[model samples]
Target chain A: MEFVQNFPFICIILSMFSAIVSFILPGKAAKYLHIGMVTAVLVLSAGTLAYVAGTGESYTFMMGQFPAPWGNEIRVGVLEALMAVIFCIIMLLSVFGGIAHVEREIQRSRKNLFYILLDLLLASLLALIYTNDLFTAYVFIEINTIAACGLIIVKKEARTYVSAIRYMVMSLVGSGLFLIGLSLLYGITGHLLMTPAKEALEKIIAQGTYHVPLVVIMVLVVIGLGIKSGMYLFHTWIPDTYGYTTPTCSAILSSLVSKSYIFLMIKIFFRVVGFDSIISSHLVNIIFVLGLIGMIMGSVAAIKENDIRRMTAFSSVAQIGYIYMGIGLGTTAGVVAALFHIIVHGITKSQLFISIAGLSDVSDGKQDFHSLKGAGFRCKIAGAAYTAASLSMVGMPFFSGFVSKYLFASSAMTAGSGRLIAAWIVLGVSTILNTVYFMRTVITIYTPVDEEMRKVHGISPSKTEQAAMAAMILLNVVVGVASTPIIRALESGLAMFG
Target chain B: MDVIINMLRNHYQDIAAVFLFVIGMTNLLLQQNLIKKIIGLDIMDSAIYLFLASKGYIAGRTAPIVVDGITDVERYINPIPAGLVLTGIVVSVSVSALMMALTICLYREYHTLNLDEIMMKIRKEED
Candidate 1:
């Protein structure tokens, strides 16, 4: 086997090791460990992405001496490797951009703990991305949930505590349903590894056995992950959970954490359940209608939100809705579109959240629309970055969001009549709504202030933050302008999904 | 009624598990007190464990371990669900503990155990 094949397991193990080691280190040491670990993971994943894309083959490494049904495994492909690279880059940039807020918002005694949770979060996300065993994925999902809760509660405020609890309660419910679903699936298929489970399911489908139970299991898993990823009506906890946290926490949770759950769902759909069975089950129709509602309703909520941070949080619900709508299309083109949107939204949203820290710094730590007036002029770097992010999110030409939106539209054109119409109508209306709120926020921040408000003055972001913001925005534009290769890579990568 | 009776007769374990799950979920969602909510979560977890355990059990099979070198597959019950149940139990304990710790923090700040009351107080303070 090539040495690059070991990179996937090493990335997961190294992150987990760092998480454990960070608990014993000082706060500054932990921070350094975090940066070093994320950078190392990024390099490793980039190398793996290059190799996997070049070879055009996916490989699975056994966790123990046993293989197949008996052993846990990690599967690495171009898609998984590319996702790992993007996750690491976004995590590193988020940390660098929001370290100031981390210092200010988190208590001194708990800073190391914060890094520990971040390391664990990274580990669990990597595990979720690569794991070939359904049971292993479940264990890591719980770990991810716990680490995310710790990240939120480290802020030490009543609001954070409340939101953290709410987040935990909802997540626990989701995981419970997921666990039960897995249990039923295991009972029926008698395999926990995804490939074996897929084989077993295919046989069952051929024999026309246990059809009712299969449908129930599908609903359980979908609803479980949907709630966790902030799908539609189940997203009530998002604003509180995403709004009250520190900027880094908010960015990571919005961009990486939720996306990991959605990615895992997509994996289960293609690998374990089999796309044919999923389509024949007609659950995609339900997901389609719900995602359509979510697309419009989420943007409406964002428009009504008075608080700037909460508005951005609401926008995430809409973004997540778009990804699900792609999944609901139930075609390979649709899944590729969903995967592309995942990357674009991850990049654009992190930039938006991290820039908020800088913008609010100049606005006397206020995040309301009125107090944020002229924040763009005060913090020029943040203002420019936020404007770029908003433009991308609004699907302007030469921005990453435009590419994903274009992909979704083209993918929708291939669907059946009813769905094609629904997808286009929702997509068009959602884009207009996206424009309304995002452009309005941009105008609000850049609006000139009177002399009385000018006293707040420019509070330039630190060099590290400025550089991170620049890297993120550059990535956004690059992914936009040079999207053909990425989309081709995704198409080829998804071909190897099973 | 006969169909319901037939389901209850054969799949009693699954029926009970689903019942317990619904009851626990309702409690978790409807209960106002933080402790009760945590209890609800625990009950829900227990329902899953029970379901898993029942799935693994067989009427005539012995324990998974071989006695007297009887290595036949049919001699033992399925062991995967047992392992999964154990993992689920450990996870639930940790989650319940985390929830309890959060409850303690909430009580420390507000001197109340009611989630609705706490949220109301927070909104009041925010304004």
Candidate 2:
């Protein structure tokens, strides 16, 4: 039991160790070793979740055996466990989807380095979700950014390098703003703990007039996290970066990296900043406006993109806005809906990306809609999986997106945000736009082809690819059907905020 | 005038930090070359370090250190931000190295270091 209690942290350390070992090992041995390490980490994370669920106690461990307010403490509560489970599942699927694509695209010499950076990225994400201290979160965010940048440019292409550099600049600015915010909180509280920070903020708020420094700090934190979250105004780097990266790299960045930042933003907004001031001051409206813009603009831009990856990249922007709009409502149901969307979108988008990988392979990099004609019959399972995932993305009934979007719209109405109501209309229109574009691609895949064309290029996915797609599709269906239980669990976990 | 001067003197450290930050921002915005932009980023980062260190300072205080039998030791400037800046410096260095590697890759790919020319080529390719 004790071993299971320590499992999440242990998995993080093990991942880091494996990353080191991956760097040191010979090239041919490294890929297998990396997969072994990730599988082990996945098992550890599962054990941790089972232990948490069985014991119903939060697991707490102070790093370096130091006490609170000084050294970091990793807490594996229900929320952390839930996020861990999601992260591990997505990571496992990514590995499955990544193997063939990585093997084909990455140079032989740099393959080991790719695995090392990938493991380090996963390790940093796990650490970010587990830590309770805000400063520790900051450190993990920095590590995550660096590791993500490395992974993005692993192929050393000029476009990839430029996009990575742009991402780097944006991340550093965001981190700087976040640090300034933290400093302000520390100046008032004399402690860096989340609970203490909240208490201190309450005391400051009780003085009637809000402190200018605190407001400045809040704005700084929002802008900083906004960049990391790739919210509308700060999202210039996203399409270019995701467009230029490989499918596997794009999946990792989109599915995990963006969500981790959103998670941190939730932690900061609810736990550290205190929701009372945020709602009372009408900053939630500002968030809603930005999110609405993102939702509308992203979908419109995506409809115009011809490149498969770029279109998907823009779609991610719209999806992120949906999550943010839910959170921006400031209702309990809204928060839960947002968290649900984060998880569901993570899995569905990753599956979609992986399936696109198969499409890319079959089409010989001709990833346009026209080039993918009749691909459904060629690789039936992947095509079916892709269709199912895309249906979920478009919020078809009995699919994952439908549940989250329903929850979000209901919550917005309950919260009485007329702006959010209008935002919901925008979201609905965008959902239709989303369907128009994605369905175009889907239909292109299944459309009848000339008999002569079929003889020349009848590429089907391998068994592993088929299995991976099936697993992802199964997850999408199961999560859709069983969303209520997960929502209830999330509600219980978030009850502490109320 | 006297009040303004007093205010300036009172917040001298903060004023200096903000000044340096503005300079860095201007350089970053105006600079055309990639390496120069990196230099501007460093300048901006150093400004933040200065701001943090200044926030930690107290008048007539020495560096934070403990000695035996120092029961009546006067207040010292906060050491936490200094420690944080050390870590921040390391982070910035790593970012700089990555940026340099990216620039090297960009040069290799485009056979040019000028951002405008490279962007033009990319636009041409897109069209």
Which candidate number maximizes TM-score?
Answer: 1
| DockQ per candidate | 0.82, 0.59
TM-score of chain A of each: 0.98, 0.95
Question: For residues A1-498, what per-residue lDDT tens digits would candidate 1 score against the true structure?
Answer: 889889989999999999899888999999999999999999999999999988889999987668788988899998899899999989999999998778877878889999999999999999999999998999999999999999888888888999998899889889989999999999999999999999999999999999999999999999999989899989998999989889999999999999999999999998999877888999998888888889999999999998889999999999999999999998899999999999999999999999988888888888999889988878888988999999999899999999999999999987788889899999999999999999999999989787777555545577888888898889899999999998998998889996
Output the worst ten-in-a-row residue range by lDDT, candidate 2 chain A. A452-461
User: lDDT for model 2, on a 0 to 1 scale?
Assistant: 0.80
The top-ranked prediction according to lDDT is 1
TM-score between predicted and true chain B, model 1: 0.94
Where model 2 places Cα greater than 4 Å from the true spot, the runs are: A55-59, A208-210, A455-460, B1-3, B25-30
TM-score of 1: 0.98
Best candidate (score: DockQ): 1
lDDT of 1 by residue, B58-103 (tens): 9999888876999888888878888899998998999999999999
Candidate 2 residue A311 C-alpha distance from true site, Å: 0.4
TM-score of every prediction relative to native = 0.98, 0.95
Model 1 chain A, poorest ten-residue lDDT window?
Answer: A451-460
